[model samples]
Target: MQQSNTYIIVFTAILTIILGGLLSLANQGLKPMQDKSIEIDTKKQILGAVVDVSEMSNQQILDYYNGTIKSIVVDYNGELIETDEKGSPIVAEEVNIPKNFKQQPEDRQYPVFIYHAEGNDDAVEAYILPMYGTGLWGPIWGYVALETDLNTIKGAVFDHETETPGLGARITEKEVQQRFENKQIYDENGNLESVYMLKGESNPESALDEHHINGMSGATITGKGLSDMLKSYFSYYQGYIEKVKSEKSVASL
Candidate 1:
């Protein structure tokens, strides 16, 4: 009996080792494909803000993103951050927005994606800004693309990790996102009030509408959360936006 027990233990140990090694090798082999998939998905989300990417293939999205968009990383003070402490150049797409949002709002770095017109280096069509915050159930994030004026929202795309189905999750739909089109972020007094979604329903037809969007019918909290995110991120990006506006003004003059 003792001899049999020893044999069982040895067999189990060897089997465990073999399985672990197999898993490690599998992971190593799959990582590159996984990373490329993630890259394509991220590009789709980013470009979906300004263009219709649903009909686009992965390679097309990659080509469009590479050809049409340029990105930059800016500090809380709105100054461009070109390199890290180790001297590796910082990349906007590589910035971990959710992790950065964990810090104080004033301490977070912002990523801006500039969308340029085809074949024209001098004409910028829009500036895309990424936003991150909590939703009713989990984390929510998206991109908002502003027109060259830097105040009007040209388009937006939002997604949540685990929001309720048919309610808060509706934020991921194009209908909800399109509501943000042409909305102004700054008020007449030059205050960055951000955009709000009223509870109950959308009031886009109201004459008084400027900074307000129609709220999700049954997802008031999610709507508010989205509004808060916009407000917070817009404030964080305000300095950079102001700098661009100043430069454009000078260029026009």
Candidate 2:
């Protein structure tokens, strides 16, 4: 009886060790695939902000991003910075948005992605900006695509970590996002009045109409958070936008 009990304990120990080793090995083998999946998902989100990528395959998304997107890093003074030895701007994808957001606005390295539509020689189709904010449940983030004029919104795509399914999560819905289309971020006086999600329905003909969009009914807090996020990020990009406008004005003269 004593010998049998000892053997049972030894067997249990060996089994536990074997199982632990196998689990570790599995995790190690899957790490590369997991990282690849995350990379693909991020690329898809970025592209979706500028164009319709819902039907696009992984390869197609990657191809489109690599072919047409030009990434530029700019400073608070609106000056282009962080170039390589060849004097080319660093790739925007390499800029860590979350980390940069944590830094002071002027100290942050902002990533701007310029998209060129097919056959449009040297002209920018849209500029994509990254935004992050807290939601009811957790972190909510997205990308906003601006037209060349820098004041008009061309498109937007949002995603959240743990927002309520039917409420705050609706921000990711097509209809909700479509409301931002053609929205103006700046007022006629050239003031930065960032676009906002109103608590109730917006009056299209109202003076503040260009800056307002209808908010989700049951998600007022989430809507406010989204509005604040857009305002803060747009303010950060103001310097670069102003620089671009000035350059264009000079070129036209």
Q: What's the count of clashing pairs in each model shown?
A: 1, 0
C-alpha lDDT (0 to 100) for residue 25 of candidate 2: 97
Name the runs in model 1 displaced over 4 angstroms.
1-26, 202-208
Computed on alpha carbons, the lDDT of every model, listed in order, comes to 0.90, 0.87
Candidate 2 lDDT (Cα, 0 to 1): 0.87
Ten-residue stretch with the least lDDT total in model 2:
200-209
Tens digit of per-residue lDDT, candidate 2, span 131-214: 888878888899999999999999999999888898999989989998999999999999999888877545455634778888
Could you give candidate 1's per-residue lDDT for residues 155-191 as a string of tens digits? Answer: 9999999999999999999999998999999988888
Q: What TM-score does candidate 2 get on C-alpha atoms?
A: 0.86
In model 2, the runs with Cα more than 4 Å from the true position are 1-23, 83-89, 119-121, 200-208
